[model samples]
Target: MSDIIRIQNLQKAYPGFALEGVTFSVPRGAVVGFIGENGAGKTTAIKCILGLVRPSGGGVEVFGKDAALLTAEERGRIGAVLGENCLPENLTAGQLDRVMRHIFPHWESETFASFLGRFSLPQGKKVADFSRGMHQKLALAVALSHGADVLVLDEPTAGLDPVARDEILELLYDFMQEERRSVLISSHIVTDLEKLCDYIAFIHNGKLLFFEEKDALYERYAVVHAPVEALQGLKDAVVAARRGEFGASALVRRDKLPAGTSAERAGIEEIMLYFIKGERI
Candidate 1:
């Protein structure tokens, strides 16, 4: 598959937090999970990709064209739901749809209406009266209604219920079935991405910790829980670790694992924690 989104050497420097040397490619039809903690530069990198925030260095390409140089015509292919992505408190759900239809020439009112129907959103009810879940759904409806090939979402499921989160995940899966559609979603909800994404990239302290296929990430990383004394010898193998009085635990590459010892399969949560801990032998 060809690359649908390419972020090469992207850097956004700040007084305290900076995105340094960020690079990755999301191939068409691939769903990439942009995983990071709060203040980990996920939002900063996303803003640069959307051309909403200017970058200090590097380039962003969307659908084979530079995002920075993209004309409005070239940009319509991407749908974004960033931050709160809220509708005006005074605008009703139907009014929100109308506004979107005008803003996006390719807007699919029928499909958007169907999504509203599916989500059971009340028409003509202003956003001021809506619950947090309802507001989130409204933002999603706006993002998906335009028939965009690439969806760039940041923290879309931050405070959603399990059911609501599942619905969003299902929608993402359904969107990818079109074959030309792809998504770059950033979230701290690791399990959600583990369920929906084809690839995963981890960012921590404004630096890229790792980028790889989700399956490979699971395959190559291991969590070795051993006695405190045994942990010392294993430090040479740890990518990140924590040691104290009780005992020591570490995340190590599979190859560095001892021949006699077996490590537990690492989950996305464990991987994220280890990477952020920045423990190196």
Candidate 2:
């Protein structure tokens, strides 16, 4: 299957920060989770994909078209929920619906209404009165109601309670039922991404670290808790290690684990922490 979004050597520069040779692809029908710390260029990459910011170098293509040159129809097929709400704060959901209907040729009022009902969002309340979660739901409702083929969401569940976050995630899963729809979601919530994503892309300090199938990532790495002395023989296998008073925990290639060293499956969060904070072996 072709990629719904392809970013190649994408580069962007700010005063003290830069995205360097960042590259990844979101395959059609897959949920590709973008993972990183704050200010790690996740938002910047998303903006470049949506043509909201000009890249300093390299290219982004969405649906076979250059992102910088997307037509109106192409833009309509992509639904994005960035950090900020684009809807007017003074407008009620009812009013926003009318406005969106005029803006998107494929807008479905019934679907929008269903989403609002499902999310328990108030239609008569102005956006300014809505809580952060409510605002997110509204943005998602708008995105889904337009029959978008691809969804680009940055921190869509940020600030939401667990229950509300789960509800929104379920909606995204439902959206993928068609097998052609794709989603690129960036979140600090690794557990949510762990449950929902097929592939994972990790960024750190404005650099692309790894982009791989989530299952493959799990299969490739293991976390081993062993005494510092045990690590002496496994140096070649260790990616990074954190030494403490009691013991040392290291991220190692599963296949290379030395005899007598027990290794366990590492979750995404643990893996990220190892990559970001642990000392490289």
Candidate 3:
């Protein structure tokens, strides 16, 4: 599939923080998860992709054109949910739909109304009176209501409860059934991403660490629990290790480990923790 969004050597500099040479692409019909600790520049990178923030260097491309120079028609094909409270606070849901009709070229009132009903949002109430979770739901409703080919979401499920989150995930899954839609989402919630994403992109300390197929990543990396003596022969294989009183647990590359070296599959969060907090060999 062709790339729907391409970020090449993307760079941004801020006082005491910098996003340096991060590169990744979201293929058409693919859901890509962006993962990182707080202040790791995921949001900054996203902003640059949407042309909401000017990059200090490098560039972003969407639908084969420079993101910053996308025409209104091209822009209308992309939907974004940036934060929990991103919508206008004083507007009622019904009023916002009227406003959005003027904004999005293909805004659908019936679709928006259905989403509001599905999300249990009140059409009569002003947005300022809604809870944080309600804000997220409303933002998502608006995003999906507009005919969008690509979705760029930053912390889209931040304030949602488990059931609501599951509902939203299901909605996204349904969206991808058309086989041409794509999503680029960043969230601290790793399990949600693990469940929904085809690819995972991890950034740490302003750098791109890895961008790989989710299943392939787990297949390549594993956690080995063994006695320290047994682990001694696998130093080269160990990317990160934790030594306990009785044994050592290490994150190892499956290909690098000796034949028959026992290791269990690692989850996305475990792999992330290994990279961020584990003792490197």
Candidate 4:
């Protein structure tokens, strides 16, 4: 499948932090989860993709067009929800709808109205009166109202309760029922991504650590429980390990594991924690 979004060696530098050689792609008809800890450059990489932050080096492309060069019409095909709401607090949902109709050439009032009703958002109530979850739902409704082929969401589900998060995820799943639709969602909530994503891209300290199909990532790594001595000899295979009084548990490459050693399937959260917090053997 062709990529809807492609980021190649994208770089950005601040006074103290830098996004270093990031690269990943969101393929058509799939949800690609962008996962990392806070300060891992997930947001920066996304901003670069949206042309919000100027990259110091490298490139980003959306819909086969360079992101920086996308025309207004090309940009209309993409919808984005950043961390901030960016909507006027004094404006009611009804007023926002009117403004959006003017902004997006393909805006659908019927679709927006349906989403507001489905999400239980109040059209006449000012945005300032809505709760965080309500604001998020409104933002999502806005993003979906326009005829967008791709969604770029940064921390879209953050600060939401389980029920609300699930509702939002269900909306995304429904959006992808149209085979050409795609999404690039960045969040620290690995479990949510685990449920909705076909591919996972991990970033650490502003660098792209790995990007692979979710199933392949699980297949490539395993968590093994063995003696510390056994783990010591397999340093090359061990990504991270924890030692205790009884034994050692390590995240290791499946193929490199010793014969007869049993390894359990590793979840995305477990893998991420080990890679971020555990000691490398």
Which run of 10 residues does model 2 get worst, by summed lDDT? 224-233
> What digit string (tens of lDDT, one per residue) describes model 1 on residues 69-123?
8877667788888867456889998888788777887888888889889999888
Q: Candidate 4 residues 1-281, lDDT tens each?
A: 99999999999999889999998999999999999999999999999988999999999999998999998778888988988675778999999999998999889999999999998999999999999899998999999999999999999999899998999899999999999999999988899999999999999999998999999989999998888888888888899998878888999999888787778999998889888888977
Best by TM-score: 2
**Clash totals for all candidate models:** 0, 0, 0, 0
For residues 1-281, could you state the per-residue lDDT of candidate 2 as single tens digits?
89999999999999999999999999999999999999999999999999989999999999988998888778989998987666689999999999998998889999999989988888999999998888988999999998799999999999899988998999898999989999999999999999999999999999999999999999999998888777767899999999888889999998888666789999999999999999965
TM-scores of the candidates are 0.95, 0.97, 0.96, 0.96
Clashing pairs in 3: none
Query: Candidate 2's error at 127, in angstroms?
Result: 1.2
Give the runs in model 4 whose Cα sits over 4 Å from its true position: 244-247
Cα lDDT of model 3 by residue, 166-279, tens digit: 887888898889899999999988999999999999999999999999999988999999877667679899998888787779899999999988789999999998898888
Error of 2 at 5 (Å): 0.3
**TM-score between candidate 2 and the true structure:** 0.97
- Is 1 or 3 the stronger prediction by lDDT? 3
The best candidate by lDDT is 2
lDDT of 2 at 247: 86
- Whole-model lDDT per candidate: 0.86, 0.93, 0.91, 0.92
Q: Where does model 3 exceed 4 Å of error?
A: 244-246
